[model samples]
Target: MYLYDHYDQAMVDARVAEFRDQTRRRIEGTLSEEKFRPLRLQNGLYLQLHAYMLRVAVPYGTLSGAQMKMLGDIADKYDRGYGHFTTRQNIQYNWIKLEDTPDILADLASVEMHAIQTSGNCIRNISADQYAGATADELIDPRPYAELLRQWSSFHPEFLALPRKFKICVIASDTDRAAMRLHDIGIQIVKNEAGEIGAAFYVGGGMGRTPFIAPLVKAFVPLDELITYSEACLRVYNRYGRRDNKYKARIKILVHELGVDEYRRQVEEEFAHLQTLAIEPPLAELERIKTFFADPAYEAGLSDDLDLSNPAFAAWVKNNTAAHKTPGYAIVNISLKPVKTLADGSKQAGIPGDATGEQIRVMADLAKTYSFDELRVTHTQNIVLPHVRKADLFTVWEKLVAAELAEANLDKITDIIACPGLDYCTLANARSIPVAQKIAERMADKAEEIGELKLKISGCINACGHHHAGHIGILGVDRKGLENYQLLLGGCEGADTSLGKIVGPGFDEDGIVGAVEKATQVYLANKEGEERFLDTYRRIGMNPFKEAIYG
Candidate 1:
């Protein structure tokens, strides 16, 4: 949680004043809808299907308990009772009035949060691993780097209007929980053989109409040159990336047109020129940023006593928990997967289509109480109580179960990631959420057997849900308004990341879940005892799943 200094505070306050004037002009008929489009977009406001949607940035997905309370207050006072957490770890309020946006921004500014760079062709939010500081396996926390990038890229004149939206991800651990390989620029922080820290750069990776795993650009970019090298890569893309055709404007398209080798060469040439000016941040500045994230004081010798016999607590610990760097604590994921349905029922789960005000309040209170007065909306559509004490695991689980938020399946097959498709998004060509729900429902009976399968769905080729990185990928497309889904197998989201390969022809909405069921059955039939679905898929390739799914 980086706090805003006077400089940062002044910038936000000035932006709010500017947007206030802009809104007044628009309302006064001086600025038309077309004229206000870019202005509003720059502030993360969008005119959606029914109402205006305002996306607030949760920088690197970090927030304090007080900040969470502020967000809850915003939800209650400004829009509807609940907020929709997006795949990028940002939160969206769908029913905002146009006039109230500036006020909302002011409210967010009070908590050192804002809506800047959340949309538009400029660099979007710099995301990192959600479990950055807490994870036991991380070489270093990636948030500080993410924060550095945020400061550098925010309103940077050179990159304010790139060819298309630019996204960057930083991962510090061996595991790619942040989906580092699926961004415009992905940096894996690694310690070299001599034990010096540096970044491994990957470029031209994205998931949209053209999905690609970023090719390696530099094996080891020194820590001092990260910003310089990144600027060089962006410069190359900005100069040569497609601008005439919006369809091919992304850096991925440029890389596809000019093979990876040539793209690497171009970036190298640019990097060589900028390397001379590269300088590391001052030690004092680095220490100042690090201070914001200093480890919270914990009682010493906390790991020595433990009771593992509580079955409910043990199940939650085993499934939704990850090892923390601290001995006495664990990072807890508050599962949003409703146990009422399997894959296909996600759309119908949680607050139903006809949910009332009371239900939304209950959901909000559940977050406020059990989750350290703070909750992180994960990229996987689940909420995380990232700092839950190990001792309180049972109490949290009990509360979550009462609210239908406890599914006991954190990485299992039923915990599908899906986007709002034709149902909500005007850009979608096919429905995605319903299809994901149906798949979840189909696999409900064999939920435990499927074991840690990631089924990701994208409504269209835009790949917003990152279907390409799923262990099992489902892409929905439209054929004359009829929903058709294409299944891809063997994708992974961990350290050994790989893009999924498409199976056979696409299946109709009715047939897609059956196809998924068949694929899972194939996995069950072929898997050795206790072997996860991903391990089985990797060991035996896609043939078995393909045969079963298609046949």
Candidate 2:
């Protein structure tokens, strides 16, 4: 975990004090809602349908066990007993009292965390692969660069308010776990023919009403000039990005209207000019950040072995773990989806990324004991213990099982990414959580049978749940004053990223789950070998799924 120095601490403390005064004025009726809107949003506070929701940033999706415990304490002490982890690798407290907002932020600051930059039109939290330092497939650990971006973008005077929100992501692994291509700026660490490290820039990739898989703007940028290049890109967007309409303001839209060649040309022009200036951070600062992300020390003679006798444990291991760079270690994912349905026959998919206070607390303990006191949040709305020794697999599984945090579905249909739709968000037209719950309940018996499906649900067109990137994307709609859902097929957010295509007409609440079941049947019948839903869809095209749903 990256520890905050005095400078970082002072900056955060000052922001908290400033926001506390703003919160007081708002509560005292001196600051009107119109006046307080931007102020509150800048500090990661939002007035939802019923209450204020606070979003807290988890930089690079990384956290210490102590921070996780504080999060659990925050959830239990002030708001609900659980919190929802978002696709951006942040956490949301949906039931916040406006008066308690300042205190909650203070508590977060005490843990070296804050909600700053979680919202606002400025560059948001920089995210990366959860398996950053531990993954065997990575070319380099991306956390160093991501942390640099975090420091640079935080309260930068040049980009306090841009056309719309800007998101930047970095991925060192060839496999894109952080939705690298779906962000405003995506950094792919690469090596040149000379065996020197650099980055390939993917600019203007985003999903909203308009979706684009970012085009390559730069073939390669030297590692030392990463910040300078990013500044050049953001400068281009700030100057030329549309501001007349909110919907048309993103850099993605700008790139779409102006071809990739033109966009690249402008960015190159800016980069050339930026190179002359002394804007890039000192090399020593970046090296200092890298020290925080060094690989955890492992026992020298640990056995690279696993006792896989129990089928249950084996099943959990197979689904919830990934290969590690170290021979004796594994990357463990703690599934937030409830392992079983409630007494009311509803699966824990109501809010797919939610974790109870107790679960959070215990998971923190597990991290401290088994994972070098470090954990990370995945873009798929799950938590990752990135360096668990292979010898501790059974023990970790047992603890998770006892805490009811063990759900043996990672990329399967049950691991749904859902946004707080009509239930909590004022922007939503239909309910997202209930739809996720229904889909999970419908597919509980058939999860393993379906296998390796990315199911995402969004309340509205904002695509907060990233429904645009799911194998089966569910978008809630308001049709004739009634809640309905429109399904999409063949979308993926991996290394080969593509937006999903809409199937057909919308379906009512009662009909949507059945429609999903029909689509699954079509997939099962046509799938060859061990094909996933996305794999099978690619082979057969969209007509089969459209017909399965419509006819």
Which is the leading candidate under lDDT? 2
lDDT of 1 by residue, 424-469 (tens): 6767888886777677666765877677898888988888878888
- Model 2 regions lying over 4 Å from their true place: 341-350
Residue-level lDDT for 157 in candidate 2? 93
Per-residue alpha-carbon lDDT of candidate 2 for residues 1-551, written as tens digits (9 for 90 to 100): 79999999999999899999998999899999999988888888989999999999999999999999999999999888999898999998999998898899899999899998888888998889999999889998999999999989999999988999999999987899989999999999999999998899999899888989999999789878999999989999999999999999999999989999998899899999999998998889989999998888987777877888899899899999999888888999999876487798765554688988888999999999999999999888899998999999889999999998888999989889989899999999999888888888779879998999999998888999898999999899889999989998888999989899999898988788888889999999999998999999999999988877787
How does model 2 score by TM-score?
0.98
Q: What would you estimate as the lDDT of candidate 1?
A: 0.78
For residue 479, what is the lDDT in candidate 2?
92
TM-score of 1: 0.92
Instruction: List the candidates' TM-scores in order.
Output: 0.92, 0.98
Measured by TM-score, the strongest candidate is 2
